[model samples]
Target: MNTRPIAAGLFDEGASPRLRGGRHRQTGRFVFPCPQGGERDSYDEVRLASTGTLWSWTIQRFRPKSPPYTGPEAFEPFALGYVALAGQTIVEARLTGMAFDAIRIGMALRLTTLPFATDPDGTTVLIYAFEPDGDRAS
Candidate 1:
């Protein structure tokens, strides 16, 4: 099956998975990757750091509101957190690999893709996440 991102420009489609962002020409400020300037009013494509530290997190014991969620059924607890990318944007993503109880602040993490679900056309939709780089994503 072909692997595809949940959304285009979410991560690098290259050999290594690094978050993609845009650097504004006007202020050198960064924005989440996209065409014609992503989040920023104007920008140039830039590759973001893959390694980062867990800044903060929480165990999501309940399912989120619908519409934009489309979350899992039966709602198993999952950990979500912000990863501080040095000298760049801090991304908020789902934390995986380690158990929810084991998630700790300041833990080393690396960019990795997680399988979300398959589309009607049979393509696999993937989501990005920060997993413990201790070994799994190392």
Candidate 2:
């Protein structure tokens, strides 16, 4: 099946994916997605760390309102959280590859992807996510 990212410039398509972030040319601060349009001129595109620590997270139990939520009609709970990429910014993303109870703050995590949706043309749309770095199944 053909596969594609949910959005362009979000992450690199590689053996081990890395999020594409932006570093401020002047301030040296980083942002998850490199800005667009004229604002992009002030930032330099940079690949972010592939691993991070789970800072905080919560279970999304309810189906989110539409117009944005494009998942299956049948809803399922999922975990999401902010991962601190060392000296870089904390990124909010879906947490996967483990059970909810097994999740813990400061747990080591690594960049990954999950199937978000499929287009009529049969293209699988993938979204970036974070999962436990090593085996911690419980």
Query: Backbone collision count in every prediction?
Result: 0, 0
Relative to the true structure, candidate 1 has a C-alpha RMSD (angstroms) of 2.9
Instruction: Give me the candidate number with maximum lDDT.
Output: 2
CA RMSD, predictions in order: 2.9, 1.9
State the displacement of the C-alpha of residue 104, model 1, in Å, after optimal TM-score superposition. Answer: 1.3
**What is candidate 1's CA lDDT for residue 48?**
87
Candidate 2 versus truth, CA RMSD in Å, comes to: 1.9
Q: Model 1 lDDT vs. the true structure?
A: 0.79
Residues 1-138 of candidate 1 have per-residue lDDT tens digits of 688888887786545787787787887776665445344456778888898999999988878787677655566778889998888788888888998778878899988888776787888788888888876332
Q: lDDT per residue, candidate 2, 36-130, as tens digits?
A: 89899999999999999999999999999997998877889999999999999999999999899989998999999989888889999899999
